[model samples]
Target: MSFVIRNIDKVIVGDGKVLSNADIYVKDGKVSAIGAGLTVPENVEVRYGSGFCAMPGLWDTHCHVQSSGGIWGVDKDMLPEAKAIRAAAQAEPVVLSGTTTLADAGCDGNISFALRDTIAAGIVRGPRLLICGYMIRMTGGRAGKDTEGEVDGPDSARKATRKMIAKGVDFIKLGATGAVSSPGMKQWSPQLTLEEITAACEEAHKAGLKVHSHAYGDEGINLSIRGGADVVVHGITLNDENLQLMKDRSIQLLATLSTYKAKLPYLDKLPRWQAVKHIQVCELLEANFKRAVKAGIDVVAGTDSGMTFNYFGRSSRELDYMVEMGMTPAQAIKTATISAARSFGLDHETGSLAAGKAADILLVRGDPLADIGVLGKAGGVAQVFVAGRLVAAFDECGKEIG
Candidate 1:
C-alpha cells in the first residue's frame, strides 16, 4: 500500500451516489481498491476518519489564477519574473480550498505555462492545470489588451490556433463575443464572425484540443456551437436556441458568475459609466442563468478568478450560485466534478473515486448533500489528497490541523 484512507463514513462519487462505510485503497498514485474491507501495508501511512464524507476533488473549469493574484497587492505592472512569483503563491490557496484541478480560462503565456509546469514537476503545490496559454481574439474582441493572441480573418485565426498548439496548450480560448467589463462593447453582441470562429475551431480540433469560447447571448453561443467549439465560457444570456445547440453538439457551458459576484466591491474604483454598464449586463445574465440551468444541458462552474476582488480559493462560491440557480447540491457538485472533468477531457485520470483513477480526493466534515453551503466554508473541508498524497488536512474540532 502506498497510502490508505480507511474507516470513512461515506464515499460520494462525482455523480452524487454515496457508498457507505468504504475503505479506499491506493497504490502508487492511483485508487487501487475501494470496498468494505481493506488492509493497509504496515509501512504505508493510513488516514482513518469517521463522520466524514469523501468525494472526488473539485475542478474549477474557468480561472485565471496568475492574473487574479497579480491584481491583489502585487503590482500587475511588475515585470514578468516578479509577477510569476506572485502567481505561484496563489496556487496554494486554491488547493487548500479543495480544488484539485484547474483550467485557466485565459491568461499570459509566460506566467500560466510556468505555473503549470512547476506544479506538474511537484516543485510547488497547485492543481493539475488544463491551460490555454492565451485567448485568441478578434481586433475588437473582449479583453483585447490582455489577450495573448489576436487575429483578423479566417486565415489569421487558424494560424493563431496553431500557434497556441505549438505553445503546448491543453485547450484553445476564443473570444466569441463582447464582454461586460470591456468598454464600448455590449456583453451579448457577437465579435468574431462565423468564418473566423469556425477556422479556429477546426484547427484546434484537428490538433486534438477543445476550444472554449468566451460567449454570451443566443446568437453568439449558437455560432460557437455550430462552429465546432467544444465549450462556451459564459453563456449567461443564452436562449432556447443555444440550449438546442449545446444538446445537438454535445457541448458544455462553463458558467463564470463569480466574476459578476465581485462587481460591487470593485465598481467604486472603475469609471462611473463603465461600472453602471457592468451592472446592467450582469442583471440580464443573472436572469437568464436559471433558464439555462433548467434547460437540462451540460453545465460546468468556475470563478473566472482573476478580476478585481475575485481572488483564488473562491471557486466554491460558484457552486453556491449554481444551487441558487435551481441545481441541487448534488447536481451543482457534479458540475465541478465529473461533469467538468468530462467537459475538459480529464475524466479518465480523475473526477471520480473509482479504481484506476487518480487519487484526487477530498474529505469534508459534513454531508454536502444536506447543506451545500458548508462546502464554501473553510472549516468544512477536512483533508485533501492529490495522486494518493496528502496535500492539506484539518481536524474535526477545527483546532488541530496541518
Candidate 2:
C-alpha cells in the first residue's frame, strides 16, 4: 500500500524538529520519503492533512494489560482466564488513543504467553506487544506475589530467566523493590538483593534481551544500576548520588507520575477507614521526578496501567503529569514518542517520523506543542495510524473503530 499524506501544516520530523507544509510518502508500512510539495503518482492514495498536526505515534514503555479489578489503593481477586479477557478488553481503546507500540510490563509468564499470543493474533487492536514473559523477583518480592513468579538465589533466577527466554520474550523485568500494592511494604524498601538482580540481568543479557527493573528509593535504585538494568521502571525517590549514577550510566527512567496522581481524588475526602500508606507514594513522586530531571537523566514516559483507575487505553494523562512536573510541551511529547522507544530498544523500528521507520503516526487537530493539555482531550487526536495503515478515526463523539 502507498499513500501521500499531503499538505501537512506542520510535521514533527525526526529529532524533534517540525517542518512546514510537508508531505509524507508511505509505502509497504514504512515512511518512504518526507519532503515538501512533492508531486504524487496518479494511482497513489492522497490523504489530506486537514489542517491537523502530524507527529510520530506515541509509545508507552511500561503498562500492564492484565485484568485486576479494583480502584487505586484497592485490591481484588483475579482469575488467570479472566485476566486474559480483561487484557484484551483494555487493548482496544489503547490503539484508539494513539499509542502504537506498548511494552507490557510482565503481565504473563511462559504459561500465560499462550494467551498473549492469542491477543497478538487479532483478539483486539493495540500497540505491537513486546512482552516480558514473567518478571523475576526474589521470593515474596513485589511483582512476585501479584503475578505468581518468584526466585531467591542466582541459580533459580537464571533458570527462571532462561524459561522466559525460551518462551521467546522480547525483554525481562525484575523487581528490585517492594511495590506499593504489596502489603506492609514501604515504597522505598529494597526487595531483591544485588546478587539476585545481577543473576537475572546477566542471564537476560546473555540471551540478548533488554532488562527493566522496578525500583524506588536509594538502595533499590543502586541495585538496579549495579545489576546492569537497561530501564528503570519507576524511581519515585532518589538521592543526589543516585541521580548522578543514573545520568553517568545513561539508564532511562520511566516516571509513571499519573499512577500517583490518580490517588489524589481518593485522598482529598478520605474517610477514617481509608489507608494512608498511599500518601507516601505521592510524596516520593513529587520529590523524585523534579530531582531526576534536574540531574539530566533521560526520563521516559510510562503508565502503570491496571492499577486503580489507571486504564490501559488511556495514556495522555501521563503527558499531563510530565508538564505539571515542569517539562516543556515538546520535551513531554519526546518522552512518549522518541525517548520511550529508545528506552525499550525499539528506536530502529519506530519512534519518530522518519524515512525507513515504521509509519506509526497521529493526526491531532491542534498543536500539542502549544498546550500539552491538548493531548489529554480525546478529541484532539483526530486519527491514529499504525504501520502506515489507518486504524482509528474519531468523529464528534470520539467514536473510533480500528
- TM-score of every candidate: 0.93, 0.93
Best by TM-score: 1
Query: For candidate 2, lDDT tens digit of each residue in 239-312?
Result: 88877888888988888887777766766554322236568767677767888888888888888776665677
Question: In candidate 2, how many Å is residue 326 off?
Answer: 0.3
Best by lDDT: 1
Q: Which ten residues in a row have the lowest lDDT in candidate 1?
A: 68-77
Evaluated at residue 140, the lDDT of candidate 1 is 59
Off by over 4 Å in 1: 39-44, 69-76, 143-148, 397-400
